[model samples]
Target: MATSIESHVVDITTCAICLEKLNIPKYLPCLHTFCESCLRTYITAIFEKEHKQSIECPVCRTTVTISKEVNTPDEWAKVLPLNFLIVGLLEKEKLRDHKTMHGEELKLFCADHHTPCCSMCVSIHHRRCAKVLSIEDAAMEYAKSDEVKYLKTHLANVDYDVKVIIKDRSSAKENIDKDYKRKQRDLEVIFSDLVAKINDLKVRREAELLKIYNEVKETIDTTLIFFQNKQKNIENEKQIIDAAVNMASNVQVMIEVEKLKKQVEEHKQVIQSKTKEIVNYELLLQDVENITKLAEQMEKACQISCKKPNTYIALSSVTVTPNVSEIFSCCRFGQHTCSWGVKGAKQDAICVSLSKEIELYGLLSYVCKDALATCDVTATVKDDTTDLVVVKDTIDSKVAENNTVKIMFPKPVKLLANKKYHVVVVMKGTSWCYAGGDGETVVDSNGVVFTFNNSPLSNNGTNTNAEQIPGFVFKISDEL
Candidate 1:
């Protein structure tokens, strides 16, 4: 009987509708108790399934009518009264659950303190809080929950984010490495060019100094030889006088004394004049020293460098050249004419001036007509003043296609900044393909014209024959 009474105590607080401890316990007309949420759900299900406006008790067959004022599903619970007995039992059980192995039970949760506290704690530390629950009730419902599956998912996301950050960092590092190497190469090239120019200047300066040195050395050696010969003649004449004084009569000595004296005087005057001529180069030597010192100071004061690569510049944008006629005669402008070997050889010359250094990366042009078979077409880049050829290329005219194409060099040319280069196109060895053009003409100091029986490849600088065909189009581009 005691055991049975204990079972009733445990079960009394549970609602038959929910099988859980009764929460917000409500009493029906038949004296059946239920949780408010469970009763609402049962009533809704019955109305939906049977079109009934009332619910029958699960334990008893008593039926209760739903009030007309119950507009929402939640309002249905309002018609039922609170089950005070069930509520009292729930409170009693909550206190029992809070009881720990120790005699004291933490029977209250203080909202203001955010903690579960015993009655003593509530009276002292959380006295101002209006409401507090027993620890077992408050902790079960209010504590932020932990679910293993959700925790694992969140941890996986954090790890994935870290990996993505690492990948981004690695890519950034690679880009930095590439940039570093590029800058290093640029520095090396710049210094190399500077060193080369310095060496060239040194060689030229040495040549000039050597010429002056040779002239000065020759003059000094010639003066020394002349003076030395005079000394030998004077010594020989002195010996002859000494011998005459010792052995010959006084008359012989006296006769030669005056004549020899006059001769010695003449030799002395000639030596004095020659000595004056050689000794008067002090001003000239001083000028040379001052010029050298000034040159040294100038070099030290300035950074010497050619123009750096800057804005992108190009050649003619027109891809095609204008022809004189259908058969290609000269219009208001001139046409590039190659009259085979019979007409002899003529060269087409063009000049480009650049303000900054540039790499001759590529060329684009159209070959309007190339019919000659054995003709060799050649091109050259040269300085206008010294005729120093910088680069030269040649192609077999027989194999050239008629469409526009890019002409590439095996190695690109590095053009110095602030200078002009003369470009010459030659048609040689029976080659008779013309680059025709006619609208405008480019006036260049380096442009010239020439006619010769030999191949145009043999020439470097422009001659009197240079002509600019207005409509001719050639394109140039830099690598960077």
Candidate 2:
């Protein structure tokens, strides 16, 4: 029976074409197996000779169609299904051979190399190592060492510090983008106003030029008509004198000449009186010269200058209540929303303490909405030391946009400095959501230091350690 089993295993493991153990055995639709290299060679030969889209199975002579995804003969064998059963058998055979040749399991730990090894491996490679321990002993020693604890603490601190740095960089980038857009808008307005003024000036100048040209033309036309009338009168007087000379005697001609002489004297007096009006006339215009000067002046009219920004410039000022002042505020860039509550536990709270004495009137929280639905959120401030709910108020979630709504308390409560307080926020219908910047951020504003804590407080005064600290601004009626 053992002989028969050995022969059966050999038949399945060996490739029929190569008559050797399969290296990457692949099977055709006919269930015939061959080595990957042997199959590729056969397929390439058939393709080169026949140039057909199908090939005959080597053992069963069954036709197998090539898929369109198989582009070349070299890829034909790769597209065939792998014989996982044969592969598993081969792996088992390899593992059996490994155990027979190597003679043991990896039960020793080489402390010098920090790796596991068998007896043969230790004798062959780790003979010169200073120390070696059994696996059990090594595990116990590692568990008791302080290295693990120190590493955990160090990694946590480093992660938090890196997150803090990332938050700062993200905020700086957001500020730069906002400032760029603002400056661009300001520049556009300035240029637009300048263009409007230039257009108005152009219209007025053209109208003035036309008015001056019409006045000059009218004066020239009137002067031409006056001179032509005077010439006609002089010619008529000379003609009358000539007619009298031709028709009458010498005495009559003398009388006519005497009468014409008086008229000629009157004509001379009229010409002398009009000599100034009959002088040469020229039209001169200053339109071109004035336009050129204006063009030159406009080039330097609006000067653009830039300098380093000494401080952060907000895009718009937020309108707060009359007497309320903000004490703490977190950045709102890289905006994110954290689930303030999960299933079963629908109430969560963020705890913080102030370093200054003031009358706490209200608080502003940046919230998120799943849809445009009306939802009411209740915020209650509880004193940690006294275990008393100091103040409570409710605000509609629809009004919360970038700290737009101040959820005010019914009455202002005065808390002592250096006291811990928590604001528990509750909402209906779904998990309460709050917006955060960079997931975690720390800020120092208004003489108070605000630190981000990943662990939020539950209703029962226990650390949930699930959600990030919500973004909020503490409002006080008086300045710190």
Best by lDDT: 2
Each candidate structure's count of clashing pairs: 12, 0
- Cα lDDT tens digits for candidate 1, 306-380: 121222211111111211111111112334443223134566565555544444533433233444434434555
**Over 4 Å off in model 1, which ranges?**
1-348, 354-357, 362-374, 384-407, 416-418, 435-439, 442-479
Clashing pairs in 2: none
Q: Estimated TM-score per prediction?
A: 0.23, 0.31
lDDT of 2 by residue, 328-420 (tens): 443323454554432233555666555555565556654435434343555667775354443343344566665335655533556566666
lDDT of each: 0.46, 0.52
List candidate 2 stretches off by more than 4 Å: 1-6, 99-124, 128-348, 351-480
